[model samples]
Target: MTAKILRTRLDCVDYQEACDRIQNWAIQRNSCYVIAANVHVIMTAYWRKSYQQILNRAALVTPDGMPLVWGIRLLQNAQQTRVYGPDLMLAWCDRAAQSNLSIYLYGTTETTLVSLTRHLQQRFPSLRIAGSYAPPFRALTPVEEMADRDRIHASGASVVFVALGCPKQEEWMARQQGNLQAVMIGVGAAFGFHSGEVSQAPRWMMRFGLEWLYRLITEPQRLWKRYLINNPAFVVLFGLQLVRGLIKGQ
Candidate 1:
């Protein structure tokens, strides 16, 4: 099921169900994209129509943050749990190993990719990583883009884990549908976190929805506006939505 939180569709899927769906898609070689929607991602989509369309058309838009999980529970289903990107990537890796599915890694720095690949192999010994590429940080030229696509296509990967981060990653995946014959998942910062290049919030903080606070404290310069501005705006907008729902129910 899905719920509209601040006008963005969030799938009310638990971790296991999400992994199963992605695995099935990979096995079938379907061209699709999965989005791990957090508060920042949701708020961005709420304000940007183009981005919202990208998310709405996604094969799966998992509630990746506690706020989204809570929002889905309040608005739609009470059983919704977070299908976080980093954790989801790990789960998929384990499943891929067990099933002998091949995966390709895209985005992030080459150094981080090397570390992440090592970590994944160390954790999931049987996992077949078809290939990996770290594109230039700037926008890719049309020819460059085609080359990248060809590279991925020729690699014969069933699943491509894209770590380009939120809006950009989402947009890239949307453009690749039909053009890319594999499941493309926009996993945002999973590469960095998994590679140990970046720190993650404690499990306690994540469970209590304080992961944002931890991120803000750690990367204040980059994340302050996102958390401070977008978060409060989301609360106000979602609160209004709840009020309207209540009024209609009454």
Candidate 2:
């Protein structure tokens, strides 16, 4: 089967296997690595047709949130551990090091980008880092956007880790498809995770569906609406769909 065919509804491969798929695809050098991202993305998929199309069309969409795994299981019973963003970044970095694949860092603040680069270099002492950039917060003109793409192409990087959060990153990757010769993965908060600006929830908290809560507590000002409002709404919608599915089965 192709790497991303829905296995039940969980719609994901496990970790070591995810790494293998990415490495094999990177070796092929003809495609982008589209991360399935997280609950917000899956919730958006349910609410937004455009987001749904983006997820479905992605070459690979690994389950990046626990709620997404549950939703996938609700649709069809499937095992899926959270393939969260930070973990995905580490997986790709290790692969890049072992395979001699160069990488470019894009998005996030310049300070974060610098720290991430140095940390990766320290961890993977032999890793080839082709380049790094931090774009202005404002929208780019067509020429400016194309110029950035050209810079990445010129950097000779085989993989680009983009940290420009959610729909923005997904939209950016879609636009750059077949334009730059490498894989571009939109990794959300992974830049902060690797740089020590955010703390990861304990594994048990993640398993128990409270990681969002942990995050909400940590950054309540930024996340109150996303978790307190959106997450509950997602649960209610998903539960209804699951109930309907069960009834149909009987």
Error of 1 at 83 (Å): 0.7
- How many backbone clashes does every candidate have? 0, 0
- What does candidate 1's lDDT look like per residue over 1-250, in tens digits? 7788887877778778888999899988999999999999989998899999998899999988999888888987978888999999999999889998999999999999999999999999999999999999999888888899999999999999999877889999998999999999989989999999999999999999999999999999999999999999999998999999999999
Q: What is the lDDT of candidate 1?
A: 0.92
Give the per-residue Cα lDDT of candidate 1 at 126.
93
TM-score of each: 0.98, 0.91
- For each candidate in the order shown, give its overall lDDT on alpha carbons: 0.92, 0.77
* Residue 30 displacement in candidate 1 (angstroms): 0.8
lDDT of 2 by residue, 139-201 (tens): 889999999999998998878888887778887887788787788778888899888777888
